[model samples]
Target: MAISKKNKSKVSVDGKEYLWWVFDEYDQTEFDGIQIKAVSSDQTHFIKYGLQQSLNNSKLVLALKNYTKLVHLSLPPKFENNEGVITKTGINRMIKWCKKDVHHIEYALDGSRNDLTEAEKQLLLKELQKIIR
Candidate 1:
């Protein structure tokens, strides 16, 4: 199901307007995770990132950082804590990553998905090794 327009937040990225929203997914009574979904003003491009944990501002920042690190992309700017809710800047960062050629493939407009690819896993392993060194 598509996110309702009333629930979505709007942001302008690089002179283009986009709409984004966070939705909770559930496994029956149990809570799954929250997915951040965004689409261009024209609706031609869509981005979705799922976090397999409960939502909060700190966790959202960490998830964005970890995802970018695994992809060998620069970490997104720190987000403001707006009462523990996701902020527009955080959504903007996701949109930026979505526009990149390398990262965009992982968040396909077609909706087929995986949390991480084997190559990304290996790269993250190497990064971890470097930090441990």
Candidate 2:
């Protein structure tokens, strides 16, 4: 079996819904939250394994620090009186974060493309295609 079984079906704990996820290799993934999966099965597996490994060797403090950094990076510039704009520093930081977070193979496969202004997106798409191809 693929091991997509539920141990405690539809149970609520402390007003939060939790699901018990099992892997065919006898691994268990339990959570009270939802996460978006990658479109490709290989990507999904790679991401899940990476997360599980990180959860094992990493401290909560480090996780929290990473979360805080992500939050800071995600915050709108308007919060700092920049009016919801991303400065060059912000873009550089974002690119740095991506370089650190993403695997080289995946990065090569899918370049830095996102829903930005048409001109920017086009430029990113062009560069991405060049790298990917």
Each candidate structure's count of clashing pairs: 0, 1
Worst 10 residues of 1 by lDDT: 103-112
The residue pairs found clashing in candidate 2 are 78-84
RMSD of each: 10.2, 16.5
CA error at residue 11 for candidate 1, angstroms: 0.6
Q: Assess candidate 2 and give its lDDT.
A: 0.24
Residue 87 displacement (Å), model 1: 0.9
Candidate 2 per-residue lDDT over residues 25-112, each given as its tens digit: 3333221222111111111111111112222232110011112111111211121114533333433332233223322121111123
**What's the TM-score of each model vs. the native?**
0.47, 0.18
Off by over 4 Å in 1: 1-4, 27-32, 52-84, 104-133
Best by lDDT: 1
Superposed by TM-score, candidate 2 places the C-alpha of residue 102 at a distance from the truth, in angstroms, of 6.2
